[model samples]
Target chain A: MERPAYRARVERILEHSADTRSLFLRTVTGRMPFYSPGMFISVKIPLPEELRIRPYTIATSPEDGEPFELIFNLVPNGRGAAWMFERKVGDLLDFTGPFGAFTLERAPDRETVFIAEGTAVAPIRPMLRRALSQPCSHSVHFIYAAAKPERLLYRAEFESLAVTNSRFRFEPLIVQGKELYESLSDEVARRWVHGDGERRRDFFLCGIGSGVLKLRDLLRGAGYERRAIHYERW
Target chain B: MARIRVIYENGSPERTIEFDPAAAPFQHDGQPGSVLDVLLGHGIHLEHACGGNCACTTCHVIVKQGINSLSEATEQEEDMLDRAPGLTPTSRLGCQAVIEDADADIVIVVPRYTINQVSESR
Candidate 1:
């Protein structure tokens, strides 16, 4: 497989939230390779003691304008993630592969439901746009659970999408008191028609491992087929 | 030690290699020197990313023959694979994985996902 060769430089870095940074890279060669919306890129960073290759999910569409975008969360101890959080604006990085199979395939089901937390929003953002682009036969909704409002990454973007697209329903769940989340799980579930006679719901569950389990259980109990509940857990 | 076979895509054919069962599993787990030790001794440059420390998928090879011959996935390796995109059931970390087989040959393919890069993407 021959990949497009290009020189990559960090064009823009947005401190969207306290913990997350959106690094926009401009491909100087201008050969924008095509990629699936939910795919990922493997970034190869050469260091002295250890070389690093960290795969981060693509946050934008097959965006081919000035800056190719990549939004990543900084894991506390992860080597590459820590380094990226410390990278300068004009720094250069090598990369390979927009590879992955975790993506949204359109189903005949009329209602679309998505659930994610934290950086999990990266892969699903494009699909959210596609779902809310027009008045489709389906009703698309999303549930986002986060540590708090402070750590929420795309507050403005999601809010705007929810406002403009009437078909979209977005719920940003913040961890309050001892209740991490699932505190609003019932409220989130009430929006869907997931009773006994209703057809199975398609759930795109993205997050860390534990949250994905909760999503799986809730969807499974409501008569959704196991296969219908797709997940891309971190 | 285990036996490993790397099949090059668009190359002459397949090549068979053997590692010492008594020696340590791939250098990353704190083994010494090169993964190319046996291969280089016999003249084979199995493309390894990062020299060989459970980093990067560049040297990725699909285990076409005997995946069971390799060591089990370490925690570090498994976490790395979680983000490796286009992951498959037969996929093994070539750098972290070492041979433990004596009777059979472990076959591998270089998956296309290892090479392609999006010029502009997420």
Candidate 2:
């Protein structure tokens, strides 16, 4: 069967950070499809010559219902970002999705670590929600890295999650520091290695292709199994 | 016009959709048409999580027949298919499999499962 593209209306828009904005879209018809955390949807943007389709990760979980959330950074000349930014409340947007395999994996027995940068936090945010919704024995750590403090998306949300959820920890790393600054991967590896080695750990990396690939190699070289590391590079 | 046969292994029904390349993105639901667009035009809701960007493998379909008729899978599509469950030699992502041969008919099979989750909680 063909997955149908539905019309969604912009319900609200909010400033996420310095350059990022979050848009809330509500289905005009049927209930929003169930999408795991880390899934994305494609939206059709009408350009001057033709329409363009672009994918954006779903920032809110399916459990949220009705309106879905998407966070995007304003690329100086990105057509999709511009189209999205121009959307007014009540304007209709055609989109299809709740796709992508970047969902949270339950490893109740192993400590889970999530590493994300920039707008990549869109998908990771839902996974954190899923992790905290259930009964979890193993600890879950979220490390968000950005070049500057303002670029760390969802810092406040994660901090609040960390405080409310006993099993979860949130670490926000800014790369602007001088001598005291450590690379994101190095900080994650050090923390992972110092833990009880017997307790297995799973790592989820998201961000730019190069960064995810680099971090995956670093973790793999540090003795984590290939299956133990999952990533989605945008 | 090319004829495409889609078999729903989950037992909803089978369909043979006719498409015209010249009228590319064959209009169905006011969307840029592909095999997925056609199927959805006919009300077949095959799972497509990436919205047909060839990013994820949820829209995987087996080209049982007329595999040669469609455009060859690009490196990106092949790479994404590697992660699809129950992969077959003739696997293709429906979003990327555009019909080009109007003389022949294409047959496709949607697998029993498409979601690549560790486990289904919902």
Reference-based lDDT, each prediction? 0.63, 0.75
Predicted candidate 2 versus true structure: per-residue lDDT over B1-122, tens digit per residue:
67778887778778777767556664322225467777765656666556565668777899999988878876546656777888999998888887777665888998877654322225
User: For model 1, how many clashes?
Assistant: 8
Which digits, one per residue and each the tens of the lDDT, describe model 1 over residues B2-121?
A: 566767764646777766655543323222322333343445655443334443444556677777766777644564465455677877666666555555466777554553222233
Q: Which stretches of candidate 1 lie over 4 Å from their true place?
A: A105-109, A177-197, A217-223, B12-64, B67-105, B111-122
Q: Best-fitting candidate, measured by DockQ?
A: 2
Residue A11 Cα positional deviation in candidate 1, in Å, after optimal superposition: 1.5
TM-score of 1: 0.71
Model 2 Cα interface RMS deviation (Å): 4.0
Could you tell me how far off, in angstroms, the CA of residue B111 lies in candidate 2 after the best superposition?
Answer: 7.7
Stretches of candidate 2 off by over 4 Å are A105-108, A177-182, A193-199, B1-54, B58-85, B89-122
